[model samples]
Target: MNQPLTLEELKQVMAEADLLKTEADVEAALDKLAQEITARISESLPVVYGIMNGGLVMAGRLLTKLNFPLEQGYMHATRYRGETTGSTDLQWQAPPSVPMAGRTVLILDDIFDEGNTLAEVVKACHAQGAKEVLTAVLVNKVHDRKNTELKIDFIGMDVEDRYVFGCGMDYRGFWRNAAGIYAVKGL
Candidate 1:
């Protein structure tokens, strides 16, 4: 509301968050993810599900980099729509269409905040009978591992909660367009 964060302040927080990834770094991560997806796409994978809204840009870009054929789908799940603290309860707008019975599924999200969302999503996938599920995320908020006791299978970039906007991440829904990524400055 109060001009959230100035460019300089944003830079400071990003430095504190240890988010030094440049624009090139983001692209390279996508490139690497594409290759990883391709390697995992062998043997008729069932579906690649993206946690909607936030995962849009990252998944869209990664989808282009896929060299092999892969089925793509979307599932809307909101954990922190209007709440400041991330939500532990996930609400799905729609269930995935592809059968999860003993099928391979790839789950993707924008950021790893508190691990609650990731953990619940993985649990849901398994509950639906997914034989094996691989989780992937673009930004890893390396603030406190003790708090976020969850592990990501394929990580694109390692950053703190400070440097966490752009390329799919957003700051109050404003800084998502930032090219190089940014960090929130104050409370």
Candidate 2:
């Protein structure tokens, strides 16, 4: 097994990271996403569900931009518990608390990488009788490996294939609070 990173080691990794998206860039993307979402679903009583841990930051930032009244909740579903890589199996730690039956549901997440997790979440909402399910992501990773047919409705930005951390994404379960998006050096 790989040893856990020390604080100083993690800091060094962050310091050497390649800046992919600056804070301003992320904010600008969010602003655009807010406008698009408002135009499409502002009047609808949408239930926004944040895919927890990773999605928290994106969801919080988006909620403030939205002008209309809507319900908010979070669900904890993860393929990477605290690792840089991912496993095929998904673990659902918690489900959304708010009811979704016959309602419009929006699922917000940090990144759309392989699209498996988002696809599963959308299916769950539909299984519970959601009238509609919409998807959004802070970053859409460019890759050829995809396992789902679901499409992200709102996208903040597109990033090249890299091991990214920050802006609600983590490095060894840390650095999710970093202001900008960063790709670790030599990853």
Candidate 3:
């Protein structure tokens, strides 16, 4: 675990961060994502699971925009326990909260970085007997280092390859509540 940053240091980090997407921009993207998702699965009565910690904000915001009736749940699986970098293996702190067997499953995550965590979660959904599994992310970090073949079905936005935080993403487990998206300076 990393030493928690002092309040002053955390403020300095935010002061030095570059704002990539404003809060309005994120809200607009969520509106669009909700529309797209509804067009595809509004009638499927899908089981939506948010990958916790990171997906909490995204899921909460997106769910309000989606008018259709669907079951909501959460799972906690992470490669980065509270750091910037990720480990090779996934850690499942909590499994799916609802059964997806023979049902359509939709997984929501905050970011699709290297894709390993999202891919593994999708695989797990399938293994749990989901008739179909789809993945969505609030942000897709554009880079060539993606290690998995999984393609996100719905994406809110594409961000440059940088250490980004905000809109449910965190910088060393902080700033996940920042209304806008930001890239850490020099990261």
Candidate 4:
């Protein structure tokens, strides 16, 4: 069997294969995303929502980049856990601490895979009577849409369905802290 793609291998592919598009090179893109989020909701103190589990690392990283005062909150909306594919059934584990009613809310998520989690979170935000609801994501998989109405207002990268890990995305419920993103070797 072939060796799994390690961090070094990802770096090699990133350099040689031009695997990441220049327009959305990871670091530059992240900086742009931070700027975009800052511009959209430039309030004194904004209630930022993190869709837990996957979004944990990304939201944390992005929050540190903001210039304005920010309050942190998290809600767990999961369509997939450790499984290779997504499931239709979505479960919300926790709700935001800050009152979402009539508040500026910025939702940070890991990936726009099936769109289920994104769509559900949007609905949840509305249900909480958010003054305005916005979204940001690390990756957007351009597959057939399970929920097309939802869109990622800010994105770090658009990736193919090769099972990515790192940059807040995960495979087998691990590898979130990887410096660069990676893919599974066989499937």
TM-score of each: 0.80, 0.93, 0.94, 0.80
Give the C-alpha lDDT of model 3: 0.92
Q: Write the per-residue lDDT of candidate 4 for residues 1-187, one digit (tens) a residue.
A: 3346777765554454313233236567678889988888876367898887888888887788888888888888766664546676666667676788878888988788778768877887898798888888877776785477886788877877777777777654556766566666543
lDDT for each residue of candidate 3 in 144-180, tens digit (9 for 90 to 100): 9886679799999999999999999999879999999
Candidates 2 and 3, the one with greater lDDT: 3
Residue 174 displacement (Å), model 1: 2.0
Q: What tens digits encode model 1's per-residue C-alpha lDDT throughout 33-101?
A: 777767775566657888876787788877777766667888876676667667678877677766677
Weakest ten-residue segment in model 4 by summed lDDT: 15-24
Q: After superposition, how far is residue 65 of candidate 2 from its true place, in Å?
A: 0.5
lDDT of 2 by residue, 27-93 (tens): 9999999999999888899999999889999999889999998999889986767675767566788
Where is model 4 more than 4 Å wrong at Cα? 1-24, 79-90
Local error of candidate 4 at 45, Å?
A: 3.3
Candidate 2: pairs in clash: none
lDDT of each: 0.73, 0.90, 0.92, 0.74
Per-model C-alpha RMSD: 4.0, 1.8, 1.6, 4.6
Better of 3 and 4 by lDDT: 3
Which candidate tops lDDT? 3
lDDT of 3 at 132: 96
> How far is 58's C-alpha from truth in model 3 (Å)?
0.4
